[model samples]
Every structure is written in C-alpha cells, then in structure tokens.
Target: MIKAIGGYFGLEMSRAESLRYPDAQYFQSARACFYALLIQGKPSKVWLPYYNCDAMLGPLQRMGIDYGFYAIDEDFTISRALRLAPTEWLVYVNYFGLCDRQQAEVLRRFNPAQVVLDHAQAYYSPPVDCLATLYSPRKFFGVPDGGILVSNVRVGSTAADEEASHQRMSHLLKRFATSAEAGYADFQAAEKSLEAFDVSEMSQLSRNLLACADTPTVIEQRNHNFLTLHARLAEHNALAFDPSTLNGPLCYPFLNERNDAVRPDLLGESVYVARYWAECQGRCSPASWEYKLSRLLLPLPCDHRYTDADVQRVITLIEKGLKGD
Candidate 1:
C-alpha cells in the first residue's frame, strides 16, 4: 500500500502515549462491545437495573434475549433477591464511579462468570475479574466513540473497522471554536446518530485522539475538582460516602434537593449541570430510588477541564442559587 512518500499533510494529532488498557477488546461503542459479547456468548436471559437508560437494553432486545428489571437501594446496591439459571447473566452499572466498593461486594454474591460489569461511568476504575467488563471511553474523553471490553469470553468473530469519525467531529469542533451552548444542538444530533449502531471495531480517528490524552493529569484534576466540590457541599448532599475514596470520578454527584432546585438557574450562569437520566421515569416508578435520583441528583462538572477557581465559582453560584438570590 506504500506509494508516495509525502504530498499533503492531514490533521495533526499528538503521537504521545495515551491511556491504554492492554488486555481489553476495543469496539465502536459500549453498546457495540456489549453486542459483540452477546452475539458470541448468546446468553438466554439477563437482568438489568431499572435506573438505566433504554440504550443498555439494545443488544438484548435486538437478539430477542429475554431480560428482567431489578431495583437498587439508595446506596446503589441490588435490593431484590435474585436467582439465575445456567444460561443467565446480570448487568451491574458502576453508577457515577462512586460505587467501586459496592460493585466489588455485589460481584461476590453472583457467579463471576454470570456477571457483567458496566463501567460506563467508571472509566478510571480498572476492570476486575468478571465475565465481561464494559467501558465507554467516549464518556470520559474527547474521542467520538469507543468501547473497551475486558472479558473472559473468547472472541468468535471480528467486526469490521468503523468508518472515520469526521462526521461526528462537528459538535466537538463547534464547541471548541465557540461555546458549549453554541454547539449544544450539534452535540445532541451527534449523540442521536449512534443510537442505531452495530458492532464494529474502534475508529482510527478516535483511537488516535485517545492517544493524545494526558491520562495522569486528567485523573488528578478530576479527583481534585470532585473533592473541592464535596468539601463545600457535603452537608447539603444527601448521598453519604467518603469523597476521597474514588480514583477519578465521573463527577461530584451532589445529591441535594437544593442542587436539583438550582440546576436550571446554574445553566443561566454558564454552569450546565446534567441530569443523571431524564428518561428513567418511564421505566421506574415515582417512588423508586432511581426515579428520585433522576429528578433530585445534580451531576456537577468536576472533570479535567476546570480549575480550582472554576470549582469555587460553581460552589458560590450554587450557594447563591440555594438562597433564592
């Protein structure tokens, strides 16, 4: 395939070593990775959480695999008693990366071979000994789409490589050039484009962009920002846990009634707080913990993009908003 030595240059990206999970399988999306695993393993039935987005059930529904919903306690622990047959599996989401200890505890009760670890929110949390552990790198990085699967299941067939991610780069470029609000519509559209994805290998563009990430700095910044938020807002936060325990959390999930009340106002101040799952109401009862979390929980930004001062700004705005100012 080597023909010309040099002619015109393309988009230049860092060749620096990026975060690498050497022992995992890569796919186009977390759903694609899950689909690949299911296509090969062919589990007859699976159990999922009611708190989850409908996207998680795509693979199972596509294959006509039967599944049941389970409930979780306030602490994110499975609340129901479960018994599984030989051909069944359970999928547990590492909610907001704060439930590592709980995840480890849950894995003990089930056969390690029948449990699937959904680390979509827990990217920094390493994969443990399990049947199949799935990670959505796009959730944590700037890459368009990528999924990592660390599993005991053997690969039966290889999916074709994904098409270039240039089309998906519109929102990213738009946001980078201007403001998040300016590109909000493009971002939503880009996300919707992946809704009907099939199993495929990770795109080369995404892989290269992933290689440019500053892993150590990103982890440190996330931890620092999260702790900063927890320090100021822990009293208002309803969810009780040691804030310093998590490695690199997705965000500082400040589960306070005040936080939820001020969420809409914060966006007016250029602080966009995301709801945990807006669509969970259809699948979850109003009295359920998940439904309450959906409405009450505020996932404040504590990622690597902001500084300590930026965090302080958010804290002050939240405090002001809570006072009805």
Candidate 2:
C-alpha cells in the first residue's frame, strides 16, 4: 500500500526553492554550460574534484585540457591545498548545500574568471556574489531536463534544438499511478540523454514549469524537514556537518556505514534514498573515501511535500536498519 500510494511521486518531492534568476542562460545540462565556459575561456589546465561524475570531466577531456583533481575533507570542504595558474580554471561542488558562507566566499578571492561554483546540490544557497554558478533544475524539481548557468563569460549561441523532454518524465509520471521502481529505466535514460547534448537554451516546457513553481514555500519546507530529520538522526550519523547550515538542502545527506542494510527497508516503505553518485565507484578506488561515501551515503528526501509524520516514518525505518533487522 505504501508503494502503491506514495511511490507514485518522485524519489524525493520535486520542489524549486526559487525561479528568480535575473540574468541567466538555461541549458540542457550543467555540462553544456561547462562546455561553453571551457570553450570561451580556452583554459590550458582545469581543476576539479576527485569525487566527480564523468559527464563533468568529459568536456575537459574532449578539449584535451590538462586537468588535475582536488580532494575533499570529511565534511566535503576543499581539504587539499590546490592552486591554479593565472589563465587556468577551477570547478568545485558545494556538496549537499552544506558549503559554508566562508568556504564559498574563499572562491571569490580568486579571479572570478577562474571559479565555477557547482550548486547542483544547492538551490536556495545564495550565489556567491559575482561568481559563475551552475544549477541543475531537474535535480531540484519535477522538470524533465534543464540546467541554468549564471556567469560573466558569454558564449555566442542561442538555444539549440532539444529532444522532447516528455520521454524523460516517465518516472515522475508513472510514480503517480505505479511504483517508482517500475520507472527507473526511464529516469536513467533521461540522464544519459543529457550527456550527448551540447549547449542549448532551456526547453519551453521546463521554463514554463519553473515559472509557475512556488519556490519560497519549497525552500522553507526543505529547511524544516532537513533540520527535523537531522535532529533525530544526528547522534547516529557520522557526518560532521550541521543541520542549521542548510538553506535549501537537496536532501538529508546522512553518511553512515549502515546504509547498505538500511536502503532496502526504506525502499520497502516507499521511502527512496538517492545514491548521490554511482560514478564514484568507477572513478575512485574501493578504499577511497569518495568510493565508500558513494556506497554508504543515504541522500534521504527531506524536501517539501513531506510532513513531520513522514519524517518520523523515515527515522523509524532507518533505526530498523541500524539494528540489522
């Protein structure tokens, strides 16, 4: 019954913290923006996180940009002291919307030209003033496909033709009447479709959905749900980040060793937790923290559309996993 009624919705409730981007270009994916920026900058060397997706690195690799990796500390800050030359570029992920104001501000200390803030996990976190910020709207909402990039560098191009997004929305659609599990292939295919796509403007359908979103309500709800879940699970959770730190967190990113046992229970309850990135497996060694984090982290949904009761349900389910039941 749980999977029948509740599983019809997204793995997480799709909500936009806001639709207000004053001057921005919408693309099919964040990678499209990265491609445009790399093309325009023509940087010789690129810096990125060791724990990252191949789609992100694909652009740099294709351009033959001399690339280097940066490491993240336990809390996912820039643990490694890394630097770039005057004409090089750097890209960083603000994991789980937990990057502090100071950490974000430090990027601005560099030439704004060299900094690309990947807010794929953060929607409500304010864009570090005058820095290039990349947002994946699909990650935050029920939209089929779209990415927004706000930057000083402009690539001379308009929205290119795009594959119809309706095909990509099957999971979101099927979940309403069936199980989210049934539509998994549709979701995976939708994501794979974005990789081959180059620079393009946001689709009309995506733009319209974004325009109609109640973003403020979504942000407020996300904050409340995250804090509530954090307060309950913080003692057992191994991550060092604070719950008060989230603006509009993508999810309650609780990292723990027990995730392998807990996930199936949550699935049985129709409570789906996202594996932040499976690509971490193929990219890093088995002993690497990034790889372990990929396998163990539970990105539990604490977005809008869930109430306190729902929060408690998820907590109860998680506790069951901790006990190895």
Candidate with best TM-score:
1
User: Between which residue pairs do clashes occur in model 2?
Assistant: 8-175, 8-176, 159-201
- Model 1, 1-325: lDDT tens digits are 7787899987777766754787788888898888988898889899998888788788898999999988999888987587778899999999888899888887888898999999999998988998999999888887777888899786543554455466778788878888888888878887887787687777778888888878888889999999899889888888887765868889888877666569878888889877778888888889888899998888888999999899999999888877888
Q: After superposition, how far is residue 278 of candidate 1 from its true place, in Å?
A: 2.0
Q: How many backbone clashes does candidate 2 have?
A: 3
lDDT of 2 by residue, 272-309 (tens): 78776788677677888888888898988998878999
CA lDDT, every model vs. true structure: 0.84, 0.78
Give TM-scores for every candidate, taking all chains together and pairing residue i with residue i: 0.94, 0.87
After superposition, candidate 1 runs with Cα above 4 Å error: 1-6, 156-164
| Candidate 1: C-alpha lDDT | 0.84
